[model samples]
Target: MKHIKRFIALFFIAAVLSGCKEDMVTVSYPEYTKAFRNPMKGFREYFGPGEDKIRAEYPYPYGSMTKEYMQWNMIEDDSSDGIDKIIAYSNHRWKGVEDINMKVILRVLLVWVEPWHGGKAKDPNNPDDLNGWHWPKGISPQVSPYKQIPGSVGAYVDPKDKTTPIIGGYFDPAFPERVAKLVEKIGQAWDNDPRVAYVEMGIIGEWGEHHDPDLSTYWPPHDEPEHVANRTWVPGMEKVLGDAFTKAFKNKKVMVRYAYEFKDYEFGIYWDSWSQPQEQVRGYEEMKKLGDRWKTQPIGGEITWNWGDLAKFKSFEQVVADKHTREYTIEQIRNLHCNHLGGITWANFNDPEFRKNAEILQKAMGYRFILSDFTYPSEIKNEKPLNISFKVVNTGSSPFYYNWPVEVSLLDAKTHQKVWSKTLDNVNISDWMPGDDWTIEKEAYQKPAPINEIKSSISIDKSLPDGEYIIALSVLDPAGMLPSLRFANENYFEGGYHPMGYIGVNKKPGKAMIDKSLFYDIQSDKTLRYNLNNN
Candidate 1:
C-alpha cells in the first residue's frame, strides 16, 4: 500500500509539470507577406472639368489631382450671389468624387495664362483657355499713379495687339480685400467637403502657380528695360493671402507655391519646378531648408521638362527612362519627401519599361505600410474580449497625411466573406510614420523605419454562432467607410481587406484552407461602390 502511495504522488507531480509546460509555451502568430505600393499617396493624376469623360487611368490605387481654376468668376461671378453660387458649383463639381473613392486638390485662381508661342493668335473668348482675366465684374486693375520704372511699359500687352500695354490686375488695391472675401466664401463651400483633399493658396499669379512675370524671381526681367518693374512680387500680398488661407482652411491642408513665400504660416509647398536642375537655388534648396516640415505638411509638384535645364531631358518619358535622370529624380523625391507629382498624367503607362520605372518612383513617394506581424488567439470565447496585436512599418518616404480608421474583422471560414467588423478607434494610423533624412549614396533613409505596434481588444459578439472564422484587417478611407488603403501584404484578399489567420468561437479553429478562387475581385464587386480598377 505504501509503494502504491509513492507511485501516485510521483504521477501527480509529473501531471502538474506537464500542465505548466503547456501553459508556458508561446503561441505562434502567422507572418504577413510584405506588399510594395498602396493607395492615397502617390502620383496625382490631373483632373479637369468634365464628369463622364474623366476616369482614373492608373492601376496602383489612389486617383487624385490638383484641379486648377476654381476660378473666382466660375464660382461666384457676382458679389450679389453671396457665396451661393460657389456653394452650388462646388457641390456639383464634387458630386460623385467621394463615392468613387477619389480626392481632389483645389485652388482658387484669379489668373490663368494661355500657352503662348510667338505669332500665335490669342482668343479672349476661348472657353478652353480658362486663362486671361478671371476677376469678377466691377473689379479692374488699379494703375499706379507714378510709372513703376520711369519710362517702363506696364506688365501685360493686349493679347490681340501686342504693342498695346495693360496693367496686371494684381496691382489693384481692392484685389487683396476681394481675394480675402472670396477665400472666406471658398472655405464655407469646401472646408468640410470629404471629396476635397487639399486647398492650394493659388489666388495669385498665373495658373495659380504663384509666379507670374510680375511676381516671379526666377523669370528674368524683360530684355527691354520697360518691363523690369513688372517682375516683382506684390508688397504685403503674401501676408494678406497667407492670413486668409490660414484662417479659412482649418480642416484641409493648404499648399503654397514656394516654402519661402509663406514663412510665417505652416503652409505646405507645391513646387512647380520640382527636380529641375536650374531651380536648385529657388526650388530644391529652398524646400530642403524646411528640414522636417514634410512630416506635417505635404511637399508635391510637377516635373516640367520644357524649361531651363529640364529641356536637356527633352520630355517627361526621357527623364524617367534615362537611368541617370531617373535615379536623380527619385533622389530628389526622397530628399524632399514629396507626396504626389503631376506631369506624368500624359505618360504612356502601357509601355512596360516606363511603367516599371514609374512604379519604382511611385513606391518611393508616399506612405507604404507593411504589415510585418499579426497576432490573435487561436480560440476566442464568446462574450469575451478578442485581443489582437499587429506591427506596421512604413517603408516609403512620407506619412499618410490623413488619420483614417483601421478595422478588424472576421471572415466566414468557408466562404471567406466578412462576417463581423469593428473599427479600432484607439489606433491613430497617421502616427505610423516612415524614416527621414534620405541619403543618396546608400539610397536609404538615414534613420531606420520604426515599427508601429498596435494593440486592440475587440469584443466578440456573444450571439455569434460557435464556429471557425478567418480573421482579417483593413484600413478604411472614411469617406465611404470602405476598405480603401490596402496593406502592402501578400495576404490581401481580392477585396481591399488583408486576411491574417483563423480564429474559432467556443472551439479550437480547424486548419485554415484559404481558397483564393473564392475571393471576389473588387473591380467586379458592384456591391462595393469603391472600384479598384481605373474604369
Candidate 2:
C-alpha cells in the first residue's frame, strides 16, 4: 500500500512538470536560479535609507568631472605647486586621480610681446615686478596692462632672438613639440594623474588677440603675403602638432580644440559654432583628417549664443532654463563623435541653470554614478536547503544598468564547513526610475533555471550532525562580464529586472504547495520545513 501511494505522488509530480512548459508563455522570465530544497518566500520590505549596500556592491573606481572648469575655477593659481592640490582633490573623490581614467589632450600657446615690454615690463607700483626685464616702448602692445603677465598662465616663453621683428608686437610662434613636452612633464609629476593616462600634446597659436584682429598689427597686412612678416596656422600646423602628440603620448589617443575661425580664410570654410548643421558635418570631415588631434568645439565670446540666449544672462541660473539650447548643444556634441566631451566653465555649478545643462549633458554622455542602494541577506535558516531574496535600485537621477550578480553559499555556523552554493547571472536592470521596486523568491530543492522555483534540498543522513548554520548571499558584477543591458541609458523590460516581481523561490515541501501560492495564499503550512532525521 505504501509503495502504491509513493508511485501516485511521483506520477503527479511528473504531470505538473509537463504542464509548466505551456504556462511558460503566460509567465515570461529571462532566467532562473538552479534548483535547491524548500526555498522560502518572505514579506516584501522597503529598502532602508542610505547608500551603504550600493556602495559595497558596486564601488566606482573613477568619476567624471570638467577639467577646464576645475582648473579655471578651483585652481586660483596655475602655478606648478598650485596644481598639486587639484590633483589631491581628484584623488580623494575618485580613489585616485588616475583612477578617473579618461582620454584627454593638452594644448599650450607661446606668445612674444617684445616691442611693448621695455619700461612697461615692470609693474609700476611693485617696482621689482619684472625683476628689471625691459624692451622698447613704442613697438609694445598699445593695450595698457597688456605687458603685465596674463593671470591665466600655463607655459610662456621669451623668443630666442629679442631683436626679431614682432608682428603687432605679439610674435606668438607655434611651439607644437615644445608644448607637448611641457604637458607630458606636468602630467608625470602628478601622484595619480588621469590626463596623463590619455593626454595628447598640441598647441593652437591664435597669434592675434582673443577674437579681435586689431590687437595684432601683423595679420591685416599679411593678405599680400610679403606685406606682413608673420602668419598663424602655418600650412603644416596640423601635422606638426599631430607628430608631437604621438611622440608624447605614445600609444594613447589624441583630441584637438576648435579655435580657428573658418571665416578667416577666403577659400577655406569654418563654422561660426558647432551648431551650424552644414558646417558641423564638414568640420568633422576636416577634423578627422587631422587624425588624433585634441578637438574642442568653440563656445565663442563670454558664451556662445546658439547654445542659448544670453540676453538675460544676468546669472548662470537664467542660462540653464532654456531646454532647447541645452539639447541642441548635446546634439552637436554627438555629431562630433565627442561622447566623452568637456570644456565648459559654467559661471555657476549648482544653480538650476547649470544643473539643467549638466543633466542633459550627463544623460547624453553616460557618466557612471556612485552606487546608491544594495543589499545581500545576512543569513537564511532551513535544514540543508534555504531560500532568499535581493534588491537593487538607482537612487540618484543618474541611471543604473550594470551587472549585480547573486551568489548563495551554505556554511556550517559552528565548524564553518562548506556545504553547497548556487550562482545566478548578474541581475541587470534596464530601468530603475527615481522610485521603483522589485521582488523575487524560489524553492530550494529544484535545479536553478529561468523557471526554477527551488534552489536545492539537504537530505538528513545518519552520519551527519546538524544544528544552526549560515547561508551567505553576495552581489557582484563578476569580473570580465558586461551586464546584458549594454547601452548607457536604455530601458529594457522583457528579459531584465523590472519594477514588478517576476522570479520567485518556493519554500513549500511539495510541488502542490509550490503552485498553490500562485492562486491562493496558504501562508501557514506553505512555509519551508526541515527534519532532523530522514526526508
Candidate 3:
C-alpha cells in the first residue's frame, strides 16, 4: 500500500513539470499588441484648437486676421498638445502658418464691406512700399485703419472719401483692378504653401462674404442711393475676382461663397448657409450639379445658427439676427456633405454629452483613415527590397486633397534610430476617398465601397548593418520635410509617424557584423582620467 501511494505522488509531480510554457512569440500572438485605429477626424477651429479635435483641453481664443494683424510669431502655447489649424484672412501674404506647422484655409479679403478704391489695372506697389505689413521688424510705419464688425462698413457714409483709409465695396469700378493686384501679391506669398489648405476668393461683400449686402441685409440697414449702387454687381465684377483668385492660388484649393456667382471659374464652394436649405441664398443646385466635386476639392463652411434650429435662418439676414445658435447633428452634418464645420462654440462643447456629439461630427468631418490590413514578412534578407502590402480607407465624407509623401523607415530595434528610409512614389492618397453616407434608419452610415490597396515597396541599402530593426511609416511635408500627418492607427510615434510593425535586420541583429579590432579600440578610451576632470 505504501509503494502504490508513493507512485501516485511521483506521477502527479511529473505531470505538473511537463506543463511549463515558453515565452517565444508565435504567429498568432505577435510580439506587438494589436491596437485598433481611432476614427476621429479633426474640426477646423478658427478661435483655437478645440477639445473635440485633439481629444483634450480647448485652446484659448484668438481672433481672425486683419491688415493690422497680418504676421507675427505665434503666441507661445501655455498648454500642452498645441494648435493644429486656422482659417485666416489673407492680407495679400502668407503669415507664419508653416512655422507652427499648422494647416490653413486662406481667405483673400480683397474687398471688405466699405468701398472699392481701385480696379484690376492698378499697378503693383513700388518695392520700397512693400513692407509686408506692420512687421515688428521695423518695416514701413503705414498702419491699416480697417475696423472690426458692427461698424466694419456702416461707419463709412461717404463713397468718395479715401482719406480716412476705409475698406472696399464690391461695385467700386476700380475694385477689380485693386483686387487683381492684391491677388497677384497673394499668389506671390502663399499660393503654393503646403500649409494653405483652401483659399476663399472672399473679395466681395462684408468680410469677403461674397454677397452684395443691400438695404434688406446690410446691418444698421441703409438704402442710400450711393450705398445701393456701391453694392451692386457689375457685368464682369465676379469674373475679375473669381478669375484673379483662381490664377493667384494656382496650386491651392480656391473657394467661392456663392456657387453661381463665380460660375466662370473652376473653384470649390465654402457654403455659409449651414443647416439651412442650401439653396435659400445660393450654392445648393449649382454645387449639386458638380457631382463628386468633393473628391478633388473641399466643400466646407460655418453653420449660420444652432444646428437644432435648422429652419430658423434660411437666409443670410436671419443667420445674422438669430439670438442663439446650436451644434449640428451627424445627420445634419452629413446632409450638406461638409468637410469641416465652423462658427460653432468650441468652449461650450467640452461637456461629456456635447463631446459625445462632437465625436460623431469629428468622425464625419474631413478624412478619417483606417489601416484595414497590412502584410509583410517577419523575416527579410539584408540588401533585399522590403515590400509592405497595406490598405487604407478614408472613412470620412471628403478626400485628403494633398498628394503628401509616403515613406517607410527601418529603425534600430533597441534605439529606434533610422537604419534605412525610402518613399513610396506611386501611392496616390488623394484618390482614396471613402465617402461617408448616412443610413438614417440604421443609425449608421455605409462607408465607401472600395478600400484602397497599396502594395508599396522600398529597397534596403546594403550599407546598413543587419540586425533586428523595427519598421515604421510616415507621410512627410516636402517643405518642412517632417512627418506632417498622423496615420489612423493607434500606434503613433513622437512626430506624427506610425509604427507598421517589426523587421529583422541581418539574421542576428546587434550581433551580426563587427571586426574584433573595433572591440580592442574601445579599451584605450578608459585612459582619460585627466581629460574627464574639469578641463
Each model's total of backbone clashes: 1, 51, 15
Ranking by TM-score: 1, 3, 2
Candidate 3, poorest ten consecutive residues by summed lDDT: 523-532
Residues 55-160 of candidate 3 have per-residue lDDT tens digits of 2432211111111112221211111212221123331233443433445675533222333221122123431121122112111222223232353333333435
Q: TM-score for candidate 2, please give it.
A: 0.37
Lowest summed lDDT across 10 adjacent residues in model 2 is found at 36-45
Ranking by lDDT: 1, 3, 2
Q: What would the per-residue lDDT of candidate 2 be over residues 1-535, giving only the tens digit for each residue? A: 9999999999999999885422210112222111111110000011111211223311111112222212211211232334465456434323322221222222222222222232223345542122222222222332222232355322122444222243432333323333344445434433123233222122232311221112123233211222222332243444544444444443333334333322221111112234333444434445444322222221111123333234444543444456664555554433332333332332344355464455544443321221211222222223423333433322222222222344444444434344554555434332332221111122111221121122223322222232433333333223212111211111112111111112112221111111212221111111122121112
Error of 3 at 232 (Å): 3.0
Worst 10 residues of 1 by lDDT: 22-31
Task: Name the regions of candidate 1 deviating beyond 4 angstroms.
Answer: 1-38, 47-63, 66-68, 91-95, 114-129, 141-168, 213-231, 512-535
**What local distance difference test score does each model get?**
0.69, 0.29, 0.50
Model 3: number of backbone collisions: 15
Give one digit per residue, the lDDT tens place, for model 1 in 141-161: 533222223243333333343
